[model samples]
Target: MMKILLIVFNWVGKGTYWRALKFAEHLCRRGREVTLLATSQHNRIGIEERIINQVRLVETPDLFTGSLRSGWDMWNVCNRIAWLRNHDFDIVHVFEARPVALFPALYMQRIKHISLVMDWADWFGKGGSVEERPNPIIRNILRPVETFFEEHFRTWADGTTVICTTLQQKATELGVPPNTIVMLPNGCDTERFEVIPHQIARRRLHFPHDMLIIGYMGSIFQHDAELMACAFDIICQQIADVRLLVIGYCPIDIRQLVKKPQYVIQTGFIEDEYLNNHLASCDVCWLPFKNTNANKGRWPLKLNDYMAVGRPTIATAVGDVVSLFETEPIGLLAEDNPMSFAEKSMQLLHDSTLRLEMGTHARHVAETRFSWADLTRRLEDLYQYILKTGTK
Candidate 1:
């Protein structure tokens, strides 16, 4: 039987943590013994363990819950590494390259003689997401540290998984073996969400049946949020019955930026059970991203949320999203401007038949291409390659 250890730098909240859990759960059902190591959400000083859907979840305490990155707890890594020495795993998959994430993963590779695969799901250094930081001084300080962690450790991996072609190109440019680098976007958890009728969902959520709902899911970075706010303002100028459904946690109150605060409905972070209900309430979903390195380097988890509920998206033409639009008529892509975005949105709003068609296509692609079952095959294939050939 294959044994796999999955290590995440943070608690079970962010996109990366969810990705690790989903992959671990999928692997466990396939008869692979999988263990997931993550930081506990609370600042407790104790470690905890449990079995969730047949996968062992080990959460180590992290103190810095207030920091932007969070989970700078090297204590857990040290203690876990010391304890992990007694266990044997065929593969160790590390998500991201932070102090807490990298240290234990490197220990598994170097000290325990286990095969290591590093996953790069975001571009966080220098010209990427660092540009999104509000403070210039903080950005300048983090440039070197972020680069060192994000770029310096790729060669240590036996294999690598990237979320987009842009990051895959960056990894290969950094001299990671091209064959070892697989472009694996975050898979849609189709099993978790069922397609609900848009009107029925709106009624369930107590939203007005007359309003044309445009939903945006999850927290967004600052740059994208500004662009989204601008686009929404423009959208209101043309449509009267429109409303913005801001589902989950957003850094800023979207109502503050828009022309009409009354039209914006902000449902702060709700549970997983109500996720589909919230998402399905939208007539159209928003994916307003500017054409930048930051947007290109990462796949938005909200895109998966939009797909799960079978809602057509009004996205700006950028990076891998453009590749997605080309492959399937899942949604319409607009230029990175308010006028263009508002225009494409108007086009979708007016045509109900086209919107429904695109929504069905979005749902189909999510089920077939981006489902966890299908994506797990690619991951397992990479594992098979490493196991058969011996780790690099």
Candidate 2:
């Protein structure tokens, strides 16, 4: 049996961690021995090690978590390299391309001849929109490292998995063979995110029974809250009983920006059990991404979750969202502005039949195309191919 090691740079809370776990679980079920190693920010916390759903998960303290002073990063990289030597892995699947992520895999390649697979989920250079760029000092320091990772990592990697076509294009431009790259888009855990009756869900969450709820769930990054506020205001003027459900943390206070603060409900980052209930309780879901280079490459996990719960989404045509909503009528797409977004959302809110139809289509798409079960099979096939054909 092939032994695979999945390496993540962060804790179990993030998107990468979930993706790694799903892959490991599926791979283990297929008779491959899979182990996932993740790092946490907490200091002096006991090592988090467990066998969850047949996948082995081991967590350790993040080497450079507290301080970024001189030599700490290198020390962490060396420690990680040393730790990696203890395991006998046929493949090292890295989720990021940072120095810490790369050095250990490079060491394993040289010493143990284990193959390496790198997954690129974002553009990772210059960071977000032009306005969102880091300060000059930070920019100057990060520019070279980001550039090196973007340009040369694929050339050295044995195999690559990309989240979107933009990253695939970037990989091809960097001279990575198309055959070596697998298009592993983000997916939903359909079993967990399945539909619950809206009335029951709303009752459990203490939301109004008659109101039309518009939900925006998950972490809010590069999402224009001001624009969403304006859109919701327009939605309110058109519809009599409209409510906005904002779940998770946002940089901007969406409640303060919107006109009807009373109509908005903020359920600050709840547990996963409550997430599906919140998603199913909504009449419509919103994905308001600012149309920027950084957003263009992202595949929002919330979009998949929304679809999995059988709710129609009104999303800005950014990133993989354009391809997702454009090809199929599962959801409505609009420009990344207040007026355009508001118009599409109002159309969905007013038309109950249309919303139901779109919701059905969205669920079908989620089950057929974006289920983790299907996606993991693809991942397993890719791993098999990589193992069969020696490292490139």
Candidate 3:
């Protein structure tokens, strides 16, 4: 049996968390032994260990509690290294290039002679996510640091898995071989994610049945939120009965951004138990991403979330989203401007038959094309090849 170690920088709740956890679960069923290492709390010094659905999850302590990003805690890195010393695995796949994940994975490869593979989910370097920082000081400080960490170590890994074509291109430009790189986008929860009845979902939440609802999954960046606010403002003028449904912890202040705060329903931070109901309540979902490097280099996880709930999306035609929209009639794509986005939203709102047809197609696409089974199989193939030739 092949024993694999999967390392992610943070614990549960984020997109990266789900990615690593799902891969671990799927790979386990494929007859591979998988252990996931992550950072749970900042205050604790010792490790907290548990088994989640046959996969072992070992949580290390992160020293810095105040910082929003994980993997900066040196104490966490040392703990991970110490923990890894006792266990032996055929392959170690580190999810991100942060200090906590990258340094320890590198140690196991260099010192222990274990095969190492790195997964690049986001572009976090010189021309990538560093530019997404709103503060100029933060951007300037992270520019070289992010570049050094994201670029300097990727080439040395045995193999690389990227989430999008944008990052695949970036990895190749950074000197990684084409053969060693695998591009796997986000997948849907076809088996586990339940689709609740739309009317019942709205009634359970006490949302009015008469109003036309437009949902935007939360956790947006400042600039993306700016584009969303602009599009939403234009939407409100033409359609007076429209409501904006926000389903999670949004950094953007919807109340202050719009003309009608009453129409905005923010659900704050919600647990996974109520996720399906909240998603099913919306008539249409929106992905108001601007045409920027940050938006272009990354694939939005919420797009799949919307698809899972059988909701048609009004997404901006940016990044790899262009291909997904052009290939499938799952949803309509809007231009970068607010006027175009509002127009697309109105187009869907006026026609319920079109929305239903597009939404059903979206769900079909999710179940067949972007399922986790196919993704894990491809990843398993990569693991087999890496173990055979070491991607040299």
> In candidate 3, what are the lDDT values of residues 1-392, reduced to their tens digit?
99999998875556587888888999999999999988885545899889997899898887677335467778889999999889899999999889988988998899998899999988888878789888999899989998888889989999999998999998999899999999988888876665666799989888888889999886887777878888888889999899999988887788788778888888888988777888889899999988887788787888888888888999999999999999999999999888999999999999999999998988998888888888899999999999999655
Give one digit per residue, the lDDT tens place, for model 1 in 1-392.
Answer: 99999998878777699889999999988899999988877745777888999999888776566334353567767766765777789999999898888898899899888899999988888788888889999899988888899999999899999999999999999999988988889888888888999888978979889989999988777777778888888888888999999998777788888778998999897987888988998999999898989999999988987897898999999889998998899899999988898889999999999999999989998898898887888999999999898865
lDDT of 3 at 54: 88
- Backbone clash pairs for candidate 2 read none
Give the poorly placed runs of model 3, Cα more than 4 Å off: 66-69
Q: What's each prediction's TM-score?
A: 0.97, 0.92, 0.97
**Global fold similarity of model 1 (TM-score):** 0.97
Clashing pairs in 3: none
lDDT by residue (165-230, candidate 2, tens digit) is 888888888899899899988887787787887999989988889999999986564347767888
Error of 2 at 150 (Å): 3.8
How many pairs of residues collide in each model? 0, 0, 0
Candidate 1 residue spans exceeding 4 A from truth: 66-71
Say which prediction, candidate 1 or candidate 2, comes out ahead on TM-score: 1
- Whole-model lDDT per candidate: 0.87, 0.79, 0.87
RMSD, one per candidate, in order: 1.3, 2.7, 1.2
